[model samples]
Target chain A: MKAVLGTMGDEVKVFGFWASPFSRRVELALRFKGVPYEYIEEDILGNKSPLLLHYNPVHKKIPVFLHNGKPIAESLVILEYIDDTWKSNPILPHDPYDRAMARFWANFIDDKCFPAFMKAVMGPENEREKAVEEAGDCLKTLESALNGKRFFGGDAIGMVDIAANFIGFWVRIIQEIAGVELLSADKLPALFKWTDEFVSCSVVKESLPPQDKISAAFKARIDQAQTNTRP
Target chain B: MKAVLGTMGDEVKVFGFWASPFSRRVELALRFKGVPYEYIEEDILGNKSPLLLHYNPVHKKIPVFLHNGKPIAESLVILEYIDDTWKSNPILPHDPYDRAMARFWANFIDDKCFPAFMKAVMGPENEREKAVEEAGDCLKTLESALNGKRFFGGDAIGMVDIAANFIGFWVRIIQEIAGVELLSADKLPALFKWTDEFVSCSVVKESLPPQDKISAAFKARIDQAQTNTRP
Candidate 1:
């Protein structure tokens, strides 16, 4: 697999925080492309790294990709930059329509699914049922999109799959902490199978943080949220 | 200019509502590309067109671009598809980093600017001030991104410019109705000038709805929202 432009020694670095799904998305994309780089973990909740602040002044969030010392922030945009800059094992489909569809789904997962999932986990007690219902609907919609395909991009993992990394791994852990079953195998068989396959895929298998660590992080977040709301 | 892949006579259609900034973004992109498309206005609040519902079942929202009978929803995604499918007068910058920057700004406008603007208009009386402040911050961030560039892409209107269509025209009108001035020239001088130039650009000029109609529409919406919440 030849480098897209053979600027072989160009520095490629990723600024990320462990347990952040968005950060994992970028790391997964870089790994998929076989791009080597240093990964700097940021203290996102505490004092954020000054380099992260300098690189991503607008959002100041990770994962910011630093290529040849220039920064690119936002996980989805970083994924596109990775694909465009280093094209080995292309993650996006070639057809214009297919590419658009992939982007559309990725945007959907980001804009709709993530929020709904969070609401189910963190909404007030009275609204938790509605939030769970909405989250379930989002999963069902995603399952329909998969339609028994091997992956969201069909036959292999691609951009949409990476964008939806949470559904493939994080959701179940989140559900466990929230004491909900929104994405159970019985509820979304196709999606569950896809998740299994996605998590086992070579690069993704190594890229994801261990489940116990993620579970502990989530518990801490939920506890902190509850503590903040206590009057 | 030759068509990218000469699917001559391809049926390109746009399902949109006249007042929607998102819809206008897609229309402007098509016009810039010199691609002929039939625009179907959906009665979004009344009875949504079955076609829109069918095409964008998940979101059930407007700005669905149907190319050769396949529907692609999400305005930014549609813009990219239009650019990829019709290569004339390319709307996105060619460099991958530039493209990523364009997308980052576009995503910023969508994820940050639009929400803050909405909060300014429709938030509770107590929260309006905070909302306005946040919206102003978003504008200042956008102004910084422009940084005296003629357009977001430098020298020409491009994807980021198209994605920020709301800020270019809709924001001023929305400000008038909301009785707040978040995009004032004194505060956002660069953004104000960009908006003036953007709205007057040949393609964008024709794509936007008439000012009087949009003003009346927004007024009605704000009035109705207030009426609904009255004690």
Candidate 2:
């Protein structure tokens, strides 16, 4: 069977949870690329629907992208698929080396900053400061990567920015509730500027979750963490 | 400047350490694609070379691929770059969905299996058994993803196979030194068979480190873990 390339008439659906950063990556990619799709919200915090299970038995996580009827899991993989399928507003750089660099930074965001951010905000009280320092180091490295450019991908936002939506939007809200200071203009001015530009973009501005809802959700998480860590 | 989409005359070089499975991924890819290049061995166990640091300052890890002076780091990113540059052998699947699946499982091996395998072999004494069980589960999930196919990418070894090189070759050696039993013909028959088939391929066979050297290398690692854990 011939592989169906991206057709405007393709049946594209996204299985995603409301507050997942990974799911938001997929959403931002679609919105950035001007693709049309139906959104199916999964209650991932509670029970994952049978449909999600059917589509993604291995990971059983959200942001499962379906083109026609086939499912693609993993946010990075789905982002690449979306780019491959729809070539108009490119999610990646045209140059192979540039594409490789974009991928490297995107994975860096996932592997380094996200973990450090989680640790800084929710780790044991004794280790919180060290985790904050480590998280700052990761952000500083990332800031260097930004390198005076308007975005990680240069003038326009690309996959790296999409991968970093949490850093741009979610962290600001979560940091206040968690009493952690990781991302801000004083420490990482370039990244802070990029976040401002990224979230301000209409495509991102309209889709980012409501500030109050995210605050409520993450507040519950911090409360849970504190309860769990009680001496 | 026009992007160089892989010219046969392009200067290619691979900076890698001998025992690293990630570095080996890049080696297998170049050999499988029949791309010729210079190999620079780095003494990663001791001190890293200035050149490696110069090329990849961010991660400062090996398996830095240089194509006409531009460096690409991160094993998976380098794999994609190689595939993108050279059109002949096609490192990734042509079909977009199939490509997505390949990327998904490749990352699964890295993200899920690698750490679990490390813990199984090198973790503290009491945690070893549970780590082994968790490692087995990861392998079992990977086995299911194999899905009766001769290779993870249908009949041929692809990125997933390359990514699982540690599982295929390194784990078999490391497990013996560490005195653990995880991957085997009885437990995961398909993956066992795939490993046999994978290593037998001339390209993989020739590039894979000699068993004696790997055994010696991993023995030192296991010994180091024992020393560190001896409180």
Candidate 3:
């Protein structure tokens, strides 16, 4: 059961939804690390796929990473596992301090940025402004952390960049649907530029979903939300 | 620059708050790894120490780990860094799958169990029952994951065990203050027994806060919560 350079015997599979940023995290990790994985798009908004359900019984969320018949749930946790299993192109930094910092910021995005963004996009009309402000604060911290670097991981796209893929593409798409601009040149100049640079990277550009498709899906979701809330 | 065994050159320090389970995570990690560190308690409720703020400007939380004057924030991230830096007593399993599983559950405790437990304890009166039910569901997942194993890491205490430290001591104290039972023998027998075994482990026992003091602190917090909610 030894892992030879390119061959790890285990069949790699990813059960994911097209528009989910969590799914995109795993996709980018696999692609960046040069690991071969079959991607299965799950029907998340409708009937839950049995494979996803079986693989992820507890959370039952998309982006369930299955390596050699073993399923690993949670996007960040799965990303780390991918980095560990595939050592050819290391996703995390070698230095322990730098690695810890990368993980800290990634966890911040997962626990802070993503949630605040969702609240801003999906929250009630009366609360959207406050949520947008909170989300802006989260993004501001991220912008400051970049510290004039091109990527969160300086000079290259690394773990923190992969963790922040949502900011690069999904945030704008969400903003388009919600008709609220959270990431602007004036408020977040560095982050605004970071997003453009991040999404344009060859690896990221190849993996990104079709912009029109995602935009349409988000528009439908917003319409559904409005319909559910009508007086 | 090089970290020699038992003598990692740089001064190790842990900025923590008493009665904070997150703080205990770092203390237990340093103790278990046999790493020498100076513990500096922070006043989390009152004015936070300047050192804590300086080290961790983002969250401004306690248990900011300092190794050779460099700060690493977030307890889970710190735990991983400690394990990575210290090669002698490895905190995480070497097997990639096992390590991923450990990280997954540790994250579950942080992202799911603790939050649900807080909601159940601190949620408004009418929502208490639903919150309690949700918290119970979270505990049920933890119990099933344990599946008669002595510890989450099989025999020895590891990262998952450290993450679940709150369940061993703090949850009961919070339950005592809230007057609600979430981890009773009837409800979570495996977890109930697991907590007993977890707290008795020498490293965990030594690092745990004094029961009476933590209980008093919880009482004070509960009283403050009640006062804030009064019309």
State the weakest 10-residue window (summed lDDT) of model 3 chain B: B1-10
Residue lDDT tens for model 3, A11-79: 889999888888999999888877788999899988889888999999988889988788999998998
Candidate 1 runs further than 4 Å off = A1-7, A226-231, B1-7
Docking class of 1: high
Q: For model 3, how does the per-residue alpha-carbon lDDT over B1-231 read when each residue is reduced to its tens digit?
A: 233743565589999988888989888888988889999988888899888999999899988999889999999999999998887667789988899999999999988898888777776656668988888899899999998899998888889988899998898778988898889889889999999999988888888888999889888877776566545
Ranking by lDDT: 2, 1, 3
Clashing residue pairs in candidate 1, if any? none
Task: Give me the candidate number with maximum DockQ.
Answer: 1
Q: Which ten residues in a row have the lowest lDDT in candidate 2 chain A?
A: A1-10
Best by TM-score, which number?
A: 1
**Residue B130 lDDT, candidate 3, scale 0-100:** 90
lDDT at residue B218 of model 3 (Cα atoms): 84
- Global fold similarity of model 2 (TM-score): 0.95
| Comparing 2 and 3 on DockQ, the stronger one | 3
